[model samples]
Target chain A: MIGFISEKLTGYLLKRETICQEEYEIYLFGMAQFFRKILVDATVVFLGILFGKAWEMIIFLIAFRVIRIYAGGYHAVTPFGCYLLTILMLFMVLLSLHFISWNLSILTAVWIFASVLILALAPIEVENRPIEEAERIYYKRKVRVFWILENIAILLCMVLHLRMGAESIVLAQATLGMALLCEKWIHGDVRND
Target chain B: MRKGVVKMVLKKVAYHEAEKSAKIICGWFFYQPKLPNAVKKLRKF
Candidate 1:
């Protein structure tokens, strides 16, 4: 659906001289993905609000975005598939958030597990986003630092007994772990042979 | 629709295409795209 819309929109943009014909392919795709994301995000947010799980959705989005920026993950085989996987990922995060909310101990466990994955497999690159050897070394260190800072944020929330904030970190870590698994072990695209 | 909405629409298109192209280019960067399906399929589920 979005792919189709983006095509038509691309035509419209070209006609209006908003984007050059030479650059329109990328622009077409960029617009399609942008609207697709916006539409997807709005739909997910609406669902979250309707189900009274708005906070979970918000936390999941934030956590996923933060980790995803540094730790690239597997891209879907196709554009539509990518959309499906994204929604699925968010749903998993929200579902697990409910379970983790049952006990702070579980949240602690999740945090530790996520920390391990980040330490072990972050700066997770893929065929889609190849990195230079030097760049790879740099991102590895950078990603770990971000992971530690995120963990610290969770710890602060935990110590203060700010349950919601703490839970957000737990949710974030869980989301990160899933992305890592898909990018590393599942896709089997690690840098090492 | 408003004029702002139109511009936002254009920007979004550009970004999406840029992102996708970036990924495709990266795949081409390594031998990933050129890999024999036989070898890669062995790794697949």
Candidate 2:
């Protein structure tokens, strides 16, 4: 399943590069990335439910999805600001986990919180000056490859989670967080596309 | 004798047209900063 998804996403990304307008292509890619995260969360929930860990799954889904949505919508905040917000959110989730007491609930809560913090703090610094034409082309190509690899890694993580265990999902999320950090350094800005 | 020359010309024209069409299709998908170069290259072909 992971290989299939990875191939499909790569084909789709390449097709978009070949056939779509640049702005629209960026938008499509961004939307696709967002949906991919949602799918991962959903898969985690599905597996959790299958294992009779419904409550843990539900909490993980809600916390992870909500923060993802929020992060997608807002990127103007500085890394420090984002870090603070994520830490606060982490505290809330931890408190909730204490009340629920589901299997691995606390661990899952910590994972979600740490994931958000990493994503939020991923350093992105855009310049006020316009980029040179040559630089622009270079950056575009760089971003394209970065996203392709990032998506493929994400799909692989999902497959591993399905076959291995919940720990794989946490590892996958961590990998994604690292990828985002890398992207931030490469693009020098948090603005999607 | 003129027919062969005309056919060759037509093939070249067709190839250029196809290249143009492909570039246009791809350009519309994203904000390509190198579009002018891409278009110029397409026209050359």
Candidate 3:
């Protein structure tokens, strides 16, 4: 679906000669990614609404994305695989949220443990997308900054007695930790290899 | 729409939209397909 729309748009642009021939491939790739991102996000939001956990899901999405931006965890090989995996992940998260109820102490403990785990091992690179040493250092520092900010946000939520908000952040951090471990286990530590 | 108007609109889209989209695809480490070699060659950052 995303590819078809992007190709159609690119074809229109080509017919009109808006973009030159050399730019066609780049534009096609970018437009396809843009469409794919929109579709995935829209689906997530729709699921959140359907499950009556809209705010919590949105908070989880934001929290997860902020760390995932620089931390770089498991990436499915194909675009369709990534899309399916994301939807499945979200479904599991929402379903878990529906069933599990965490006490403040458990949430805080999980948050602390996950935060430390992520800090110790992050910016995990994959075979498909390898990170240079310099870029790896930069991403490592950048992820720490985001991680600290999330901690602060979680602290504020806890202080304010916002159970759902705190849970969202903690859950996101824990999920990210799991993703990092999975990426390492699946791909092997490229740095060490 | 007339040919001229369509061309004008598409020209704007081709420039602004393409640049914006490409910048985002490059900037984030989000889960998406690998960028084509052509796009990777043109990456400024």
Candidate 4:
């Protein structure tokens, strides 16, 4: 479906002479990406509304993206697979948020534990896309800055008695920690074999 | 004059979108800064 739309857009662009044949692949990939992002975000927003946790969903996305961008983990094989995994992950996070009776102490503990996990094992290089030393050093430093900022925001929420806000951020942290661990385990197995 | 400006702006936007899309295709779908050009080249090689 996304491919068809992208192909149509590419054909239109080619007809218009806006992008030449040489640039076809780039535009097709970019437009498909543009559509994929919109689809995922729209679905997430719709789910958040349905669950009445739109605010928390937004918070989770920010916190999670900030960490996950640098602390790379668990890439699905295909674009469609990635989309499905994202929806599944969001459902799990939102459902847990709804059901969990989160308290300040528990949230803090989880945040601390997740912080440790992420700091220790993040930027985990998959066999396919290994990180270079320069990139590793750069991303390691980058991830720490975001991690500290998240901690401060959580602290502020706690001081302000915003339990739900803190819980959302902490849950995001825990989600990344689990993702990192899963990726690490998978990487280890591949290495052993 | 206006058409030239519009074309230039569209070109910039297209470049930006292509860069971002390439990164997400390489990594996961999320906000990530473009890696240094040196690193990008080295990875490609």
Question: Given candidate 3, what's the lDDT at residue A1?
Answer: 81
Q: Give me the displacement of residue A78 in model 4, in angstroms.
A: 2.1
lDDT of 1 by residue, A1-193 (tens): 7668878877877877776767665666465546655776686687678767887677656665665656665566565666566667666656665664548678777878877876777666665455566666766776777777777877787688877777866777766776677667666754664
- The DockQ score of candidate 4 comes to 0.19
Docking class of 3: acceptable
lDDT head-to-head 2 vs 3, winner: 3
Best by TM-score: 3
lDDT for A97 in candidate 2 is: 36
User: Comparing only chain A of model 2 with the true chain A, what is the TM-score?
Assistant: 0.29
Score every model by TM-score: 0.75, 0.26, 0.85, 0.81
Model 3 lDDT at residue A101: 76
Clashing pairs in 3: none
Interface RMSD of each: 9.7, 15.3, 4.0, 6.0
Error of 2 at A161 (Å): 32
Candidate 1 chain A: 10-residue stretch with minimal lDDT: A28-37
Fnat values, one per model, are: 0.26, 0.00, 0.24, 0.08
For model 2, the stretches where C-alpha displacement exceeds 4 angstroms are A1-20, A68-193, B1-45
Q: Note the DockQ of each predicted structure.
A: 0.16, 0.04, 0.31, 0.19
- DockQ: the better of candidates 1 and 2: 1
Stretches > 4 Å off in candidate 1: B1-5, B12-45
